[model samples]
Target: MTTVRGTIRSTNTIPADGHGDDQSTARARAVDGLELTGYDVVQTNTLSSTAAGNITVRAVARSTEIQPHEASGPNYGAARAAYLQTIPDGWISLGITVNA
Candidate 1:
């Protein structure tokens, strides 16, 4: 419950649209973006959807750390919004997961 160093792989992936050259690169960006959005990303992976063209990104990440600073102020919301801004066109949010 409250003592969770236990973050799940809720990493949201940006679409491949001009974000990176390949899946590996995109995954790297996912890690960076997650961190920028206020997550201490521990592990990362990618999943491709069964859906058709241009919708091929699913970033999986687990946040192993949650700082005390995250308990107040704007938290990840404002930072997350800024991070989302960096995502190029055609890449909608796959979404984010709070510590579970």
Candidate 2:
């Protein structure tokens, strides 16, 4: 089994329409080492916005370690579920405060 842990931070400009550039923020952080050992980041809190100042996301990631041979169809499914189950479905941004 392999265990992975990391921190993720997302930031974006707040938009009036409630749409912000969360994609770039997530992408940037993804490479920072938030991705799990045997899993990948399917999505980030992008659809949500920091329309007020800046969209910020901070999460402490923890994932179970699965072996390659052990990763059968059912195991893969369980992994997927375990990963997706942690993230929130939707988020509502109120405001943001930019720094620097």
Candidate 3:
């Protein structure tokens, strides 16, 4: 079994109406970065605040793959690359964890 569970905290400057979609897009990119395409979403949460015309958003996404075969381990290198490639501007990863 392989499991990837962690919180991705990020600060962004976005408008209120665009916050939701942007957050969702960020979460999806992070998930794709982890290479958990077929995994289940354990939990997802986001919190946002606005100040000085900038909105800071914190997104946490948890995912898991149960009883995966040998080929199912997380590709950390690729994941990192994907994260770097997909993450939106001004968004950063606070932390992450992976268990297999």
Candidate 4:
């Protein structure tokens, strides 16, 4: 089994109207997408700051077959490719951890 834990941090400027619901929705969609790709999400931690217009989401996902890899030089190319394809646009991968 392999465990992949990571913090995905993003900052979006709140509109003048202060409608940040869309940002929240986007974050949810990103997590959902990961689940759809066959990872089981074990835990999630979210933090948002209205004053700073910043949002940080941390999720831990586990998979029996998939292995984690370093972003600089990924040993599991297919896993990395799947992750890249799964993540929604506009969301950045801030950090990742893999445990076997």
Candidate 5:
């Protein structure tokens, strides 16, 4: 069994060029497995002022444990591959700093 944990920090420039608060959103994914899709949302913070606004989000995600019996598939990598595809497309990962 393996455990995965991470955090996310994001910010955006608002009211750019007098452009009235551009709508924006951010997303973060856990690991590269189907079971890793679900995460516990730790905290989300928003800082706003006359100059700029910022947002910070934190969360923790875990991967599914593989059973010994289930590891004998014809395609050894199929389990992992299936889990990878289960992840949503364009999902942004914010745990780079931790892993890097």
Candidate 6:
């Protein structure tokens, strides 16, 4: 199986009326180095910090990762399309890195 890593954080902003964004304030929380072994999440190391006192969080849209196949098909395009449909609405990638 192949593994990948990404960081996830909330984009929600918590407005504080009485609180402040001073040195003691916690603005944002992120899970860095979150490893994904296929569809299974293996690691979730947390990293917390703030930027510009705005609870800034950086992220990308959903991503797709195609698993490795052990079987061969005559028409890869047709088979791939049909197989891709089985995946629910989410990330859908086309290829992978094979290590020999």
Estimated TM-score for each candidate: 0.27, 0.26, 0.28, 0.30, 0.20, 0.28
State the local distance difference test value for candidate 4: 0.46
Q: Write the per-residue lDDT of candidate 4 for residues 5-98, one digit (tens) a residue.
A: 4544332212111123445653564465454344456555555545555554545555423333333223455545555555554445666666
Minimal lDDT window, size 10, model 5: 11-20
lDDT string, candidate 3, 15-91, tens digits: 11223335566455444444334434444444553443333333333333222111123576555554455545544
Backbone clashes in each candidate structure, one number apiece? 1, 4, 0, 0, 0, 0
Best by lDDT: 4
Single out the weakest 10-residue window by summed lDDT for candidate 6.
Answer: 11-20
> What are the runs in model 2 whose C-alpha is more than 4 Å off?
1-23, 30-35, 57-100
Local distance difference test scores for all models: 0.39, 0.35, 0.41, 0.46, 0.28, 0.31
lDDT, residue 34, candidate 4: 58
Winning model by TM-score: 4
Candidate 1 ranges with C-alpha deviation above 4 Å: 1-19, 36-38, 49-100
Pairs with backbone N, CA or C atoms under 3 Å apart (clashes), candidate 1: 9-61
* TM-score, structure 4 vs. true: 0.30
lDDT of 3 at 81: 51
Clashing pairs in 2: 2-65, 14-50, 14-51, 15-51
lDDT of 2 by residue, 7-99 (tens): 222322221112225645544654354545543434444334455634444333333333221111234455444433443333212222221
